[model samples]
Structure formats: C-alpha cells, structure tokens
Target chain A: MTGTEADHARHNARMLRIQQARAKMQARRTLERGLLIVHTGNGKGKSSSAFGMAIRSIGWGMKVGIVQYVKGSWETGEKNFFHAYPDLLTFEVMGEGFTWDTQDRARDIAAARAAWERSKELILDPDYDFIILDELNIVLRDDTLPIGEIVDFLKDRPLSKHICITGRNAKPALTELADLITEFGEVKHPFKAGFKAQKGVEY
Target chain B: MTGTEADHARHNARMLRIQQARAKMQARRTLERGLLIVHTGNGKGKSSSAFGMAIRSIGWGMKVGIVQYVKGSWETGEKNFFHAYPDLLTFEVMGEGFTWDTQDRARDIAAARAAWERSKELILDPDYDFIILDELNIVLRDDTLPIGEIVDFLKDRPLSKHICITGRNAKPALTELADLITEFGEVKHPFKAGFKAQKGVEY
Candidate 1:
C-alpha cells in the first residue's frame, strides 16, 4: 500500500476500536435487586437519609416496606404524608409515644420486635425491592434485641432484597458486616443551640 | 381579657399560628453524616447530582468522600479535577475495563464488592460529613453481593449517619424507607434515536 493509504488504514483501525469500546460500555448495565445500608452518628437526619432512598426506590416502581423502629405514636409529618404513596409500605414499631414518654422498655422492645418480624418477611422475600428498618440500631444498642442474631439473619437474607437501616450508636460488628455504612457527625446542630426542630423539617 | 385588647390579641395569635405552621412545613433539613452515595443510571448525569451535593456540603465545611464507581480504566479528562479542593476525599473504582469487557461476573463482583467494603469504612468513620455511594445500584443488581442484606443493614444504622443511594431501579423498599425520593424519567434522551453519550457531560 502507498504511505498515505497505510497511515489512513491504521487510523481507521484505531477509530473502529474506540467505537467498539464505547458501545460495549454503553450496553453494560446492572439489574435491580437488594442492598444493605446503615446510617448512624451524632448529626441529624439518619431517618431522612433512609427515607430519601426509600422514596427514590419507589419512584422506580419498586415495592417498598418500612418499619419505623422507635418513634411510633407521636404524629410525624412523614408518616402522614409518605403513607399516601401507593408504592410505599409502612409500619411503626411503637404504639403511642417514645420510651421516655411512655416509660416502658418492655413495650418498646415488644413493638420493635414486632416491627423487626414484619421487616424479616420483606428482607427474605425477593419480591420486595427495598426495606427500611428505621431506628433499629437504637434498639440493638439499647439491648432490646440480640445483635448477633440480627446480623446473622441479615447476612443470610435473600439476595434480591435491598434493606436500609437507620439509627444512632451503630455497633462495630454491624458496621463490619454492612456492605454500606454511613456515620453522621454533628458540627453545628440547631437543637443543641436551642433551636427546636421544625415540624416538617426535623420530624 | 379586655375588649379592645382582645381584638388585637386574636390577630396576633392568628399571625403566630401562621408562622408556626409555615415553619413546620419547612423544618426538614438534609442530614450530616459520614455516609456514601452511589448515583448510577442510564438516563444521565448521575455523577453530576452527586457532585452538586458534594459542592453544597463542602461549602458548609463538612468533610466529603467520593469514589467514582466505574469509568476509571480509561483516562477521562475529569480526573483530579475538583476545582482544587484538596480536602475532598475522591477515588475511582477503576474498573480495569468496562463490565462487558471483563465479561467475568466473579471478577466484576469482586472488584465492586471490594470497593464497596472500602467505602464502608469511610461511611462508618465520623471524620467525614458526607459519603456518596455513587453507582452502587449497578453493583447490587449485578449480583455482586446480597443487596437485601445491604439495605437492611443501612436501615438500622447510626442515628446521625446520612446516606444517599442513587441509581435507576432504586427499588420499592428503598423508596418506601426514604425521606426524599426523586426519579428522573426520560422524557427525551439524545441517545434514543442515534446520538453518542457526550464526553464530560455523560461521563
């Protein structure tokens, strides 16, 4: 071949390879199944983070199951509002109020255990896409439930189930077992500075 | 109790009520936590959303961590290009190649799960304010690991932890548990008919 023709041939080959590479990359995609997430720390908004993920997942036409672990009875704007979503499934662990308000550890543990049971179904079922275990870490940390059993159960859950757990005092074992973990640190909190949490914002 | 003062008192009470109600509606604020979020979707700009959140969070002097999940093998122009923010924790998943190119599920899963494990430490550490689990859905759906367990773990995490899980097929359970959910439907995609994903824009 002529010098110019050979040069053109090499350039064309390189271009072809680049195009192929791009096509392959574009075609690569992963399917939707399950996840395990932990949101913990001193900063605020752990529930919000879990809830945010829940809402996004539902928007994709995925079935969602939520178990609010601790703050159950008191009216929450999110509970009132998010329950309206047809795709979202929700359960509150407590019956009337917080532990301090009710002053009953037995009641709290019973409620949390009940909620955890319900969550187990969702976690083990491949049919459900996402599961939110809100305030579960608090329960675990407070000795309301056995952490080892919980971790073991979670470790063996269905491959298709995606779970999100939110609360404070995330245990080291839990963190070690988690595929994804998040810790929130408080730098400047409105509440610590005497700013009461607003209704829709903080609640 | 006076008649003249009573009228003014009623008006003042009404104003207070209005202000309180408005404040309640806007009370919700994003959480601060050492959490990681992965934004991956076929639609577009998953990373852009993450970057936007990162910039906003960093502006508040909150430590931020980011690991670009996928698209690392090739030398993209956007590497180490965060406007000279040395404090931002950044890394690339470094696919070594695209998922299809590797064509090895075990290898892909290993790489993804490994990256996820590394991210787990950062997410659990309180030193960082925000951790972005970008494109994590892809890994979950790929059957790299058990997504259900992952979700369950997250739901019961620390109280202060804040997490963001972004990607298409966000899963129903995730949506149900999230505080805020946004779905970007494809009203019009440039690639639908026949257009290539633009550099810097799509990547």
Candidate 2:
C-alpha cells in the first residue's frame, strides 16, 4: 500500500479501539435514579442553568415546581414566560426581599421557613418530577435555616424525584449530599465594567 | 429607650448606612450596550445556560437566533420546545455529528464553516436581539475554524447585538474579547457515580 493508504489504515484501527473502549465504559453506566444537583459559586448562570433544566423537563411533559427563596417578588422575565405554562409549572416567589432590604433577622428567618415549607411539600408531592430550590444556598449561608435539617430531608427524598439547588456559598453538607455539583466562576462581568444590568439579559 | 428599643435603633441605623452605600454604587452604573458572553469549562450547563438566556430574551418579546455547531441532529428537548416559536426564534443545527463520529477533518471543517456562515448572518441581522453559537468553542479548539478570523469578525459586530457562545475549552483569544465569561467546574458528576444520563434532565 502507498503511504497515504497506510496512514488511513492506522487511523481506522485507532478509531476502532477508541469506539470499543467507549462502548465498554458506557455499559458500566446502567444505574438510573433521581439526582441532587447543586449549582454554586460567585458567577452568573447558577439560577439560569436551573431554569434551563426546567424548560427541558417541561418539554418532556414533566411537572416542575420552583420555590424562589431569595429573589424578591419582582417582575422577572423568566417568571413572566413560565407563567404561560400554568398547567405544568408551579412557580412560587416568596421572598420579602434581600437581607439588607428587610434589615430584620427575625423576618428573614420567617420568610426562609415559609419558603422551605413550600419546598418540602413540592419535594414530597408525587406529581412533581423536578423541584428547583432557587437560591436556597443563600438562606443556608445566612443561617436563616438549619442546614442539618435541610440536608437530612434532601437525603431521604423519594428515589425518583430530581431536585436542583442554585445559589452561591452552598454549604458543605449540601454539596456532600449532591449527586452533581457545578461551581461557576466569573472571569469577567459587565457589572464590574460599568454596565448596568439590562432587561431580559440580567434578570 | 429600653434595651430592645436601643437594639432596634442600632439596626435601623446600620441598615440606613448600607442602603446609602448601595445607592451610591448603583449611580455609577449608567452605561448600557450589548454583551459578548462566553460559557466554558469542563462541567455541564454551558449550552443549557445559553438556552435559558434565549428564553429570557424571548420573554421580553425579543427575536433570538441559535446555531448548534457540534451537537448532532438529534431530537433535543430544547430544540423541540424552541420549534414552537418559529416566528420569534430561528434554531439551526448544522453539525453532522461529533468529530469522532464524523472521522473526517475536511468534512468537519466544512461543517464548521457552514455553521459560521449562518452565525455571521444572524449577528449582522438587526432584527435579532440575541444570538447563540452553541459549541463553537469546540470547533475553535479542534482547529476546525481559525480563531483569529472568528475573533476579528466578532470584534466588529454591532454594538447593540448580544452574542453568546458556549462550549468547553474556549480559546483564550475568544475569552479575552468576551464581555462576560463563566468557567463551570465539576465537583461531582452522577455519571462518575454509575448513573446514566436521564431524559429531560441531561438532554
């Protein structure tokens, strides 16, 4: 065979070896169950990634429950769009405001307790397939809620229920219970570059 | 004042100081313009987060365009969902398959070129409010497309158009030109724990 033909033969042999190895690796991945996903760190896309997962779940006719623990009850673009799917999605925005806005630790703890009560119900409900605890980490970080209690409950959740938690400073207890964790780091931000948060993009 | 009253008074004064500082900071953020956003690294949600941004943009009655450069022409949950909004979104999946599946360098380069041409058209179109170039970073990393040429074109894009690119191992030149960059790191993945990818959640 010519040099080009020899090179083609070697490439084909290498590819076959890779394909076989991948198939063997895939065969070992047969376990299927609900996952505890955590998205945390000081960057964008933590909540947005959860929102995207919500869209994917709804696309497959799955029921999704979202309980926003820290976001104020503002008119967000996501909330407006998600409202169109009333039958599939139940979105409950129950926050008095940020910690500074409320300036009352007692009130903040009360709000977190109320939100957790709602989240607990959704997590236990059989109708819901996915539950998004948006920014629940902030509540844990501020010590508004007991981390041990929350972690214990999450650990004992139903086997077929998928739960996603999004926010910065995820507690070590929570991360240890998670099946998947993605830490988003900021390399650059427009806000630090003198740009105000724009509608639809930053919301 | 009583002891409790004095404590409340101090809290109120501290809250007032924080509110004033935030107000002063918010005053300096007056600039507004489009953003060149990049999502990269070795974790999930790079594409999913971009899809979430598409939803946010569409929620505000903005037109969106998407070009999937590396994902094969399979039925994805996001693709099916976005198809419902034909008038508002233009979804294009241009890749034949991943490089391993295709196994042809010339063919891969051709596919990347085709996808880039479509992306260029969307970026230049004034009617589009947001554009997503999904997995274009993989194309740049593989040398399927020249990084310098892509960077130069993006540098000259309209100041009022928002563009988002998502994939792993994003080129340094691209990130340097980006207004916002997020690096997603994997702490733990379910796949490593012997869990197969689930429908609606991993798609």
The best candidate by lDDT is 2
Over B1-203, each residue of candidate 1 has an lDDT whose tens digit, in order, gives: 77845754655566466656655654653333333233323434344445545544544555667654565454432343342456654544534344555555456667777777777776777776666676666666655557786778677765454566666666555555554444433323434434344322233
lDDT of 2 by residue, B113-135 (tens): 99999999999999999999999
lDDT of 2 at A63: 90
What's the C-alpha lDDT at position A48 in model 1? 61
DockQ for every model comes to 0.03, 0.60
**In model 1, which runs have C-alpha deviations exceeding 4 angstroms?**
A1-33, A93-96, B1-203
TM per candidate: 0.45, 0.94
For model 1, state the Cα shift of residue B150 in Å. Answer: 39
Best model per DockQ: 2
Flag regions of model 2 displaced more than 4 Å: A1-16, B1-15
